[model samples]
Target: MQPHEKVKQYLDTICEQIRYKRIHNELREELENHITDQKQAYIAQGMDEETGTFKAVEQMGDPVMVGTQLDRTHKPKPEWSMIVLTLLLLLTGTFIRLYTAPRETNGLELFYRQLLFTVVGIGLMTLCYKVDFTILGEYSSILFFALAAIIVLLMLVINPVDGRFIYASYPLLLFPALFAGVVYSMSNRGYSGVILCGIYFTIPLILSLLIPNITITLFLTLSYLVILTIAIQKKRFKVNQHHALLLVYVPFIISFVVAMTNNNLIYRLKIVFTPSLAPMGVGYMGNITRGIMKGARLIGQGALPENLQGLTVEQVLPLINSDFLLTYITHRFGWIAFLIVVALLELFIIRAFVLCARQKSVLALLVSTAVTLTFAYQTLGFVVTNCGFYLFAPLSLPLISQSSHYLLVNMSLIGILLSVYRTGHMVHDKRFPEKPDRRPFLTIEDGRIIIDLHLD
Candidate 1:
């Protein structure tokens, strides 16, 4: 039989048993190329054509086994480590609420609500994992504009409840998705890619400023810097240091200048930098928080500290269930619990970075890395603010905080990250053609085919 006919027969047998038909053509092309190369080597060594083809086929091992092995390698699998860590964090948040629930406030009720949110978040995450993340890349422009419009509407229409502005959590939550799309769309474009990214970034920046939520604005700005840096590092965009610095610092300078004019912001800055100068009425919370943290020491006050048990939420610490939850944890459960929470957060962020490194597609890499930075920055901000380093933002810890919007947004981002991880290595024939096998298992040396069976 001809070499081509024999190869086709073998491929047909292998593909027949393979479960995933989508990869059948790719696997066939790879095997054919390897077999063809092997046959050519045997012919060069003076073997007859028919014998060369037969020998090449013989060396490929069993078709069924090869096909099954390829299927297993390409199968989609969840990152269970991430899922478990997320659940653990969610449980910890529940424990904190139960332990610190004031007599007037229903602790059990809050825990049930948090549990419901966790269940919903996990379901959404699973859906994201199963779907093709690259599809988001295709519709990035539409998604960005839609999200941008939502932010604008929220800014104009939503009235502040209790004199506090509502955060743009929906827009911020969807930022990574919109970002992944933008990055994918501009992947091969040169300088234009950077320009397009900058334009996409402006929408959130403007909306956050309009809401006068400096915290969200700062978060968005930092996210933009991270995305830009990753793009430059990946060689997707070429940017000089001067231009990169301008891209980063220019907006920040402008924002800082604009923020200085607001009296409320000026007061927050005083609380952060010069607490002694802060007004006695409003800035007293910083002092109270410091006292609470100091009283906790190495071990916390043991679930319900006698000193803090009877105090109401307003009297104990403002925003205890949301922004001040970590502080409350330290005050009630002690530094050890705080450290445990921080440790878990570090693991989550590190895992994200590891996943980002493993991504083969540039768009996935950008999206995953952006998600990692978003979490990292928020965690840092939360910790810093709790430690009394900065008093300007009410940034919540990713999964440990009790805000419904914050929890849902962060969980959705985690879902997108998992999606990117699952689809990172997928390759399509149109975009990435199969290359000649160069795995170093076999080589043509001195006009002869040499197979190195020894594992390195």
Candidate 2:
């Protein structure tokens, strides 16, 4: 046998003992390099080629033992804590929904629906955990455009709840994650790439604008801002930091300004800050929510004011199962429920952020960070609205909101997050490799136009 065959056979035997195939290549490389180094060291001491190789393999303990040790070391591990937390949150949401809902046919119906979403959500989370998410980064552009196309298409269909096409903003919830992929794809493309990101952002921005859905508009705006900031801070772009930031925020700033001036959004903000100004108008829910909070006791069933016109407290603000679930729990049960819910949600987001930020792969880090921020913002929006700030019209707490549509969206986001944490160690990405000076799309030498057919 050739001298190198000994090393090859050693590695093969070692790999055979390791069951997790995902790290097989890395394990093989590590062992091969180590054996080669030992063989060369022996050769430097005047040993012949075959003797060096044989001696190296013999001195290294049994391949089975080595591989067994490594098999235990290198394996794909899921974040069971996050998984358990997710299931707990889902159960909390289901219980709260049934608790808030009337005890009748309608309540049982809601129970069944929540049960279905919960089961489906768990299944989706499991599937996402099993599948690798790195491939999403591979087809980043396709996913972005496909998402953009869906946003545009959804704009044409009217949302039944709000009677507005843009109000059907479910797709907008995922904009942040796919944008992470776009940001990764545009890596090393320079200022032009950064500008393309802004351009791509406009599709959803405009849809949100026409839909005039402030919640999603702000969701998209903040998501891109945070993500691009991360990219620029990391020097992922090939342009000046200041310049790339300018390119990124120009559209957001413009949208913010346009939204403030155009949509009576300014009036809405005014009422949210000072609910009494429109106590029976846009601020009705906020005003009632504050009333409920003021009357809430520390541990017992709090009383709703006698003046309010409602058969039950749910009739006062009407979103008992979703946007106002926290408020309902606080007022109806006690402050303890509120604290528990807040603690769980806060823990989930905080820990998720800590985990996501630790990702070694750039794409994984970016995507997971974006997902975390989306969760954070939506939670803030929902909590603030429940805590007597602007009702925000349609903000829903992640797992706490029991709506069918949002249940799916929230589950999908969790699934993606679980996917990231599950594969954080298993999947690696080359998102920022130095590119070869391959053929350019266009050349302008000698005032002549040369379109290069070779695309890298």
RMSD of each: 11.1, 5.4
Candidate 2: tens digits of C-alpha lDDT, residues 1-456:
233888889888999998777668776776777888998999999999889989999988999999999888776677888888888888888778777766333666776787887788777766766666665677888887787777676666655455567345776788888889888888887666776788888877887777668788878888889888998887776556876676667766886678678557778778888887888888888788888888888887787766773557766757677668788899878999888888999999999999988898778888899888888988898889888897466567888776666777778888888888876776666646554335544467999977443433
lDDT of candidates 1 onward, in order = 0.71, 0.78
Residue pairs with clashing backbones, model 1: 300-333, 300-334
For model 1, the run of ten residues with the poorest summed lDDT: 429-438
Q: Largest lDDT belongs to which candidate?
A: 2
Clashing pairs in 2: none
Off by over 4 Å in 2: 1-19, 25-64, 103-105, 149-162, 166-168, 210-212, 261-263, 309-311, 431-456
Q: Write the per-residue lDDT of candidate 1 for residues 67-175, one digit (tens) a residue.
A: 7787787776667888788888888777776665542255556667777887888777667666667667767888788888787766567776655457554456567
